[model samples]
Target: MHAAGLGKQSLLIPKQPLLLLHGLFGFRELGPFVYFHGITEPLKSLGAKVVATRVHPTDSIANRAAQLQTQLSQVLKQYNTDKVHVIAHSMGGLDARYLINKLDWERNIMSLTTLATPHRGSYIADWSVLNIKQKLKIESLFKVLDIPLLAIDQLTPQYINECFNPEITDVPDVQYKSYGAWKQFESKFSYLYYFGQLLAEREGRNDGLVSMDSARWGQSFNEIPNCDHINIINWSESKFDIMPTYQKILSDLYHLEQQRELKWSIR
Candidate 1:
């Protein structure tokens, strides 16, 4: 939700660069269209250095992380930043978590902030997996199209609970933050609305695609009220501005860096 008077708020970012990550079936850009929509350019205009990166649209987390690591290596070379903050949405959050945990990015990464991410996996994935006929058809189509199907299996709640979460433990020094949207539309024609209803039947509150509970992770979790999953990226049906929240997060990162520096000095 876009809060009134958010534009009046002024926030500043430090020297640390920001890396923006997109979710499943996402891309940096397709012609004039962007995955992060209005986020990157606006942040850049504010003097915050940022990288909006792309990964395999549908691939295993390990594969996606490898791709991200390669890009991050280049980004570090170009920017010369000691540490960077990661802002990831949806399935990209899982990829970020994996990169940090298994790939030993604890030293280079200062923080990770996720929006509408399914940290605990989603009911939608579970339902999709259970629906064998449909799943098979879709899998066959993806195979014919040469798209990987392993990523879809990984998003199931069971996989995350039993296999993933245990492996992807968080580092103490790297701060983690999360945000979720719970608002859903009642429109019958919208696919998100339909998924929202499915999730709502058992999950209480959802953001059309992901449940708020599933979205929650890390040391802090914030609610973007009256926002759906896509709305978090500024492309949803609402006109809610997402820049303010992005600015606030960067401001917070700056403060956190100050605190870290002070701690290092004390030691």
Candidate 2:
């Protein structure tokens, strides 16, 4: 699990620092728990300056975006850099998009790489909200608990398709890439396995929650096989090891940085 014996060659010194943004119900560090478990230290060892940001676990994307913008500004200042390459997972991708597009941070972000994010939206969110509305009617209770159902609403197909799609546009200067994970089990024992089957039945291929089609966005896209939503982010409970995938992504970003530098030199 350590990067020292990973056998991967250290990468060239990066031009821009890397910032990791976690997904729904994510935290930077809680005791020994890390949202992006086994990610930051390995990347740092490879000569990439990396930082994982913490945001509201259950707030609306706009609210989280604002918080990320503030945190990113502080990070930029701390590193004495003008821009950063972002690796965002799940809902964090939406927050990053909102920050770049709506918060005027396009120029401050070099590239964005999203992992298993519901770019088009998720049916599960729709189902959850609908079920809650009909059965629990816990809107008031959720508000009192500071649980933002608005965040869940934003992840629904209607919001992403009808509202969010129109409001957000890709910035020309920033490079964008997306990766999706597909759950590959048919076991009823695993809740995520069953959920993946349900989504696959209706949506073709899915990573338990987000469908491959829904997770696809950005200029380039990739599908990672044999992993669920949480697994794609290298969680401890993952069925498969995802450390190599992280290394590959970081390598791609290094290439992107090289390309950008080459273009700048030509100009």
**Top candidate (lDDT):** 1
lDDT of 2: 0.84
Q: What would the per-residue lDDT of candidate 2 be over residues 17-49, giving only the tens digit for each residue?
A: 888998877899999888887778877766778
TM-score of 2: 0.93
> All candidates' lDDT scores?
0.85, 0.84
Candidate 1 per-residue C-alpha lDDT over 48-151 given as tens digits, one digit per residue, 9 for 90 to 100 = 88899899998999999889988888888889876889999999999999999989988898999999898888888878766842746788888888888777
Which pairs clash inside model 2?
none
TM-score for each prediction? 0.93, 0.93
Off by over 4 Å in 2: 2-5, 8-13, 236-239
In angstroms, give how far residue 147 of model 1 lies from its true place: 2.0
Off by over 4 Å in 1: 1-9, 130-136
